[model samples]
Target: MSLLRILVRVALVALLSMAPLSVAAHEVQPAISDVELSEDTVTITLTTAIEPILAGVDLEGIEDTNDSPLSDRVDALRALPPETLAAELAERWPEIAERITLRAGDTRVTPVLVDVTIPEVGDTEIRRDSTLLLTAPLPDDGSPVTFGWDAELGGLIVRQGDDAQGYNAFLTSGAVTDPMPRTGVAEQNLGDVIVTYVVSGFDHIIPKGLDHILFVLGLFFYSLAWRPLLWQVSAFTVAHTATLALATLGIVQPTMWIVEALIAASIVWVGVENIWSGGRRDIGWGRIAVVFGFGLLHGLGFASVLSEFGLGQYFIASLISFNVGVEIGQLTVIAAAFLLLGLPFGSKPWYRRAVAIPGSLVIAAIASYWVLNRIGWAGDIPYLA
Candidate 1:
């Protein structure tokens, strides 16, 4: 069985690592680029001079304000035509032009996924910023070589030849700068990094950070008993918190792969040890100390999201809110799990075998895959950093 497991792991690693033959062949010629086949989603960013608008809106309870129902506001906004939105903006145009502008039309007036992030930038007064994420599937066989977009969207659309390209454009007071070209990378935001960080951090909790979700779930599963669960959670919290703080302060730059690998390992060790090892009383604090150390690594892994968002300005507030948002996501997961899995199913025989074992196996296998994949022992193409 041991040999079989080892072989399976080895083979899986090889498969994951194997370079796609087509990609390998074309990787060097004419400086091959990543061709985005479709606009899985397009993000539109709007910038404005925030200090003045801060008066029309409240900043202190920004998150709390969102709690009120916005269905009516959404409907009203969505009902307005692009022209109406432009006219409405015309009223605020002078100040809007003074602060910031959009290359694309800002008047979606639609109930799109809009995020407003407020943070104080350097030497500048505290202000508000907004980000809009727009995702629309692409048409069949149509590629975008070059394209232009109208401000009142459904109005002006531009296109070039048959190259499927996605664009990120920034509209300022005077000219439209192709941020895509400026960054030489697709969709890299040069907005108020602080706002971007907060928006990204919040988005990650629900949408992008799947690994973090699994790790938190693994923690919740071990001894779902409140006391034991609380102990582990607290330990994990303290450790990650310490590391997150340190990493934000520039004390660490550990590779994300290692952090992830260790995170998986931590889950496996805790769960496997829980199932077989007799009593914690027998093990000294030395073992506990080891976990704390690993937790520190995990913390930095968590902070990777925020750090990638950039420390620009308002690092402190952004850091605290991001951490709070993460904790909220974590607690929400546990709360939902307990409601669904614990209350009705905790005592049943099938629950333990069905839920616990399968859960652990999945987590272990995933971690093992990540470890092998990261170590490059898998036969996969090397990606440029």
Candidate 2:
């Protein structure tokens, strides 16, 4: 077989390896926890979609519950009535409680389940949140407290103290919070806030934002030439940054479904252009304009995730840091593509035919599936739904 044929087979195998993740369209969101400290007791009210936990879905490094082996169980649990689900959770509380961690200094404390409040099931497609109320006795030595849970429970956002003051942090799976005082938790400094948001942003792209990853890869496969790629990436960065700020500030509000559908379509557009452009290194202004427009859609996607982290008092700093992280992620993707494909094979005479075109076809095919899936056209399909 020829080199192009062998490369094509390798590409197909790689695509097949990613088939498991393609249907994982529904994102597993982070749970929000509010920690209140009293003289002798500490109370935590956590609101999260309890179905995945009840269904035994392993949430560590999982972007969507549908990616779990127990996804069907999660679906069934999601359809349960509020009271029924609450009862199931109560029955499972013994095992679940053991996974919770409430520490005062070096001493671990057991937290008792005080109550659970489950809401009426709305759209089954949308995650239904249930609130878990837990209380634990504080140590008498006046030691600071920390909170965390098993990494399999996924990411968490903790808000300690009142609305005006306290510590706010997004903890990754299996991670612990900084020591929080019993009363009047100090507000996080601006420097710390920047670091936190930046990591969150980068995490979204590297691990969680698979759709965005494919889109960036699509851009990378377009050409090996640096100038054209630079122009397109620069346009994309500027446009998305503007819209991320606008959407986050509530200045521009667009329907989420439309934004998502358009984002998938944008990926399809770029992938198709890579093949149709016929190995042209000089891109026109129209290409840059199209990329800029698509960047606006992608920014809205970022805003949706950042909104979950809640900016608190460091809104401006957090937003800028998050954007910086996103740029870093995009640059990382570009760099990897250059190292793997461009550096080794870019100078080869048949590189476009063997690599770029075949890769673009794969990207286009996957994104076309996403477009159909997002718009509800292919929802009935079993695995790729």
Candidate 3:
């Protein structure tokens, strides 16, 4: 066999081996904090996975704890019982506390730990969340306050007040929130909201959204012609956008695992169709319809992420901006693929045999495994769990 073929087989084997670990083994999600301001105190109740924090893993721009040098330490911390872990965090409180910033105008306020709530150790593979309740006394002059933490702690959603129009913002990279008002909802300018969420949506696609990237690639592999690719993408865009809106508005809600299973299945369907069709230049209307249907499933998946972090009072604006970012990311993927593959080798007679077919085979095989894993058919296999 030629070197290219040998290389392909090796790459496929590596992918298959790593497929199960991609499911959420040690993925780092953003931390969320609910800030409540009373006359004398500013209290923040933060909900986050405590293992990475306790293990001293730097979470900046990281998705998985395994990517850090301290991943084994993180896993070890995860095995500890709730009380044990809480006590460990208590021991580290002084160091952790200094990293948190609570400012009331020019005055720096220090917050004291009120409580720590860690869930009992369950499945070690699955993430377990812990809560921290910290409260600091307000300034005597009643100055508006702003909150931030070490960027190494990862992204944070700061929600002040309980109203729907309350001040809400996502802070990352050492960014702090706008000064929160002592009275009613603090107003966030429209332009800032747009920029924040657009970046968020784009980030989700370019680097963070691997599964979505593969699905888009599956769409691309179906045809090299612009018209066919455009039709399928347009259908997908419309369908996912609609469902993303519906789900965010709380109109359509499906069990999250079921949606995830169906999304993996969609990838399988698209990949299989590409291989069977053998790089057809024209797409059938039926193909467009199927793609649209799968897009709806994918939209629900998108909404699930948003729901976890929240959109706050700027729900409509954030939702629209995020979708726009996702579209930009999708187009970028297609453009990159075209420049690399379709532009260079698409006209060759062997392109279909050498590129599209084998690529689709890999996409299908990996997604097929995902389907089994997502639907619980794979059981608690040691590596997968």
Per-model C-alpha lDDT, please? Answer: 0.44, 0.81, 0.82
Tens digits of per-residue lDDT for model 1, 286-344: 44565577678778877775443444334565566567666666676677666656566
| TM-scores, each model vs. reference | 0.47, 0.83, 0.91
Error of 2 at 143 (Å): 6.5
**Candidate 3 residue-wise lDDT, 64-105, digit = tens:** 787889988888898999889988888898898899889988
Q: Candidate 3 local accuracy as lDDT?
A: 0.82
Q: Which one is best on TM-score?
A: 3
Worst 10 residues of 3 by lDDT: 12-21
Worst 10 residues of 2 by lDDT: 15-24
Stretches > 4 Å off in candidate 3: 1-21, 377-385
Which model is ahead, 2 or 3, in terms of lDDT? 3
Between candidates 1 and 3, the one scoring higher on lDDT is: 3
Candidate 2 on 1-385: residue-level lDDT in tens?
A: 7875586557544532343335354468789998998768899999999999999888888777876889889888989998899889989988998898889989999888889999887546557788999999987988888899999998899988653345788887688888888877846778889998888888877766767777787777777888788888999999999999998888898898888888989988998998988377788988889999999999999988766676776778888999999999888877876776777778889778887888777777878887887788766777664
